[model samples]
Target: MARAPVRSSQAKVVSNILEKHGYQLGQYLGKGAYAIVWEAYFKKWRTNVAVKVLMKDKAEAEFLSKFLPREIQVWKGLKHPNLINFYQSIETTNRVYIMLELAPGGEVMDKIRMKGACDERTAGKWFEQLCQGMAYIHSKGVVHRDLKLENLLLDQHDNIKISDFGFCKFAATDVKNLKQVQLSETYCGSYAYVPPEVLQGIPYNPFLSDVWSMGVILFTLRTGKLPFDDSNLRRLLKQMIKGPIFTQKHASISLECKDLVRGTLASDVHRYSLHTIFDHPWMLPLVRERPPYLRDMDALYLRPHLRRSTQRLMTIRHTDGGTRSTANLVSSTRLVHPEALRSPSPPPSPPAHRPPLHARPPLQRSWGGREEGGRAESERERERGRGLAKDGRRRE
Candidate 1:
């Protein structure tokens, strides 16, 4: 399904609202089922930023009452070199706007599509960064259920910046005297990266499920293809249960690399925890790359063009006490803007002459499906999944 085109009047209304909030809306970046991402320039920060606008009327009740709030809470609590920075979240009656760090280098999956697989060094470097970021997320007790190549974004320096936390949730803890791990029942995330336990309809540790997805990501990075075919759910589950099979394509990858992949994709009991993964022989030797601020300090000091912009980024501090290169301090005490106010009043939408809801085109693919074969294949996969559920498997 495709998103209805934004009418000129609707665009003008959104731009006006953003302009009042100190942002100058630029080009349309992309759109999903109920949200649209736009490129905008922040007057105060003096840098390009991405704004994700979620249409209230279009969003489902579950999203409004559950996932959206969870995403905002988890995103705000996080601050890390490899994680995308969250600046501000604003709500008007008709829409919810989330301001975020702009990653100019685009999605990591796009790179795999254009060039083939990454070499050992390139894959290792990014994977190390991802592990560090995920470790931080777990320490904060947040589990990002949706972990895939498409969600791994890159900045101007080609550094990894994990994005999209729509399905994120805090790890369940014991209600009685102490904190303990609790298994999750929800079946979320892309089918290609989901672990076997999740597919089996059993309560599973989401942390381990995340580790499994990371294995899928690493394998694809090295081999330029999914380890198991996901065109059919029954076939996919069978392959996962049998475990990943090494082919001629995996022959060139180092022994230690193969071991690491195997360990992560292993059944829950044998799988390595994030801490154990960091201590693995394959990961132990790799040096985590320095962030841009530290790595390019000398060059930035020498060049005026780079120094001016870089210094500005380094100066702004989030209230969380971390020094981020690309985030602004959006604390209530520091600044107050009209747009930041969470008023219940509705903002104007397109004029009454706009097309009816049913008359509009269907929505575009959101964060849910993989883009390997584009929309046609995605729709077919959904149909097949529905058929499986009706057949009494009730796979969800």
Candidate 2:
């Protein structure tokens, strides 16, 4: 008889492997159609990591055999600091998990939820960073077709980490037969973020579709939601299929944000490229001046579990311990004393009782007889642990 293939996942074993690899699970961040993300820590670097656990099921054959490999390939080709880091992959007999750079800030959507809408300054800045990341990926010949608030992750210090490359394409190689590839049209991505050309039968420019998505992101960021109105998929698709014009509810939005959305959302086929939208005046300042805030906002909102990743940036790290960068490194910035950037303190430490069993002993034990010796030893161990934790901080 043939040997049986493994059944029932080794969840605990996989979890242990993650911990051993310096990844400690923090929380259940989110899950989508294929994978679940757990906030984790990479102890080696004292940073957070997003562990994407791909669910294994008989129905997930297509994702595992096809899309997963493509995602890995696209990620491996990418090397920008602003993009989310894809660390390593965990393979078991049945399931798969990928460890990634955790964004401490959370998601861009959270920012909108917190402040209603981002100001022009913030929106522009973020868009510029989006450009940088997109440009980098595009330069590498990859097009992130799905560019939206939900997919754009953030790390501590507010840096954007473009994520979910599930729908990404290796443009340089994918266009092996441009005619066949371009002509093929099978829709994917969030309904709210799809572009007009995608809705029509036309062979769309992936870059332009990305631009429209970016416009949508900006509109939502500045106004707390999308620029369109629809209650169903067919209706939304029909509305998005039209020309690039958006009628703003003036009572609900500012003229400035709506204007940018109007100009950026055009489907004239000529105006949808990032090269065109990025050239706008409102976006120019953001292109030149808004990285820090955008990055910081990313940290505060999108990747809160992935802390300290943005604590030091090439932009500011070169300065003389200042927030600004100096002549040492061009355009690189770093976070100076980011611990100071912490949120309103966490719930006060659980009532300090006997130092938990797991805590390293910190005090000196007494070498007395029997009963007295036992009591003293326990006290000494805790004293030593507290001292060590304090000393480690002081040394830093």
Best by lDDT: 1
Q: Candidates' TM-scores?
A: 0.74, 0.63
What are the per-residue Cα lDDT tens digits for candidate 1 across 187-233?
66666687766665555677788899899889888877677655444
Residue 335 error, candidate 1, Å: 40
Model 1 accuracy (lDDT, Cα): 0.66
Going through the candidates in the order shown, the clash numbers are 2, 35
Runs in model 2 deviating more than 4 A are 1-11, 173-184, 241-260, 289-396
lDDT (Cα atoms) of all candidates against the true structure = 0.66, 0.52
Best by TM-score, which number? 1
